[model samples]
Target: MAIFDDEPRKKARPHEIGQDLSLLSVDELS
Candidate 1:
């Protein structure tokens, strides 16, 4: 993993969860 991201992406789960939750407030359009 890249510490914040990942290669295969599985490792990015933590990053994704954090960002996704953070973005949720502004992601109402999506």
Candidate 2:
């Protein structure tokens, strides 16, 4: 239910948001 709402919000700004997420993921892993 809540997941559905979050999906569109991300898809709405995928390019910018996606890049940030990728960086965060890498930093967290590193």
Candidate 3:
């Protein structure tokens, strides 16, 4: 039987998501 990769990855926490947004803002402005 072939093993299936069925488990979904967990979402990032609020702090991590915020950090990503900040990085995106910097890139857009520059």
For candidate 3, the TM-score is 0.37
Q: What order do candidates take by lDDT, descending? A: 2, 1, 3
lDDT tens digits, residue span 1-30, model 3: 122221211123344456798755554454
Better of 1 and 3 by TM-score: 3
Give the Cα lDDT of each candidate: 0.52, 0.61, 0.43
Question: What is candidate 2's TM-score against the reference?
Answer: 0.36
How badly does each model clash, as a count of residue pairs?
0, 0, 0
Per-model C-alpha RMSD:
7.4, 5.9, 9.1
Query: What does candidate 1's lDDT look like per residue over 1-30, in tens digits?
Result: 365343435544455568886654444333
At residue 12, give the lDDT of candidate 1.
48
lDDT of 2 by residue, 1-30 (tens): 879866855665555455797765554454
Higher TM-score: candidate 1 or 2?
2
Lowest summed-lDDT stretch of 10 residues in model 3? 1-10
For candidate 1, the per-residue lDDT at 1 reads 39
For model 1, which pairs clash?
A: none
Q: How accurate is candidate 3 locally (lDDT)?
A: 0.43
Q: What lDDT does candidate 2 reach at residue 5?
A: 69
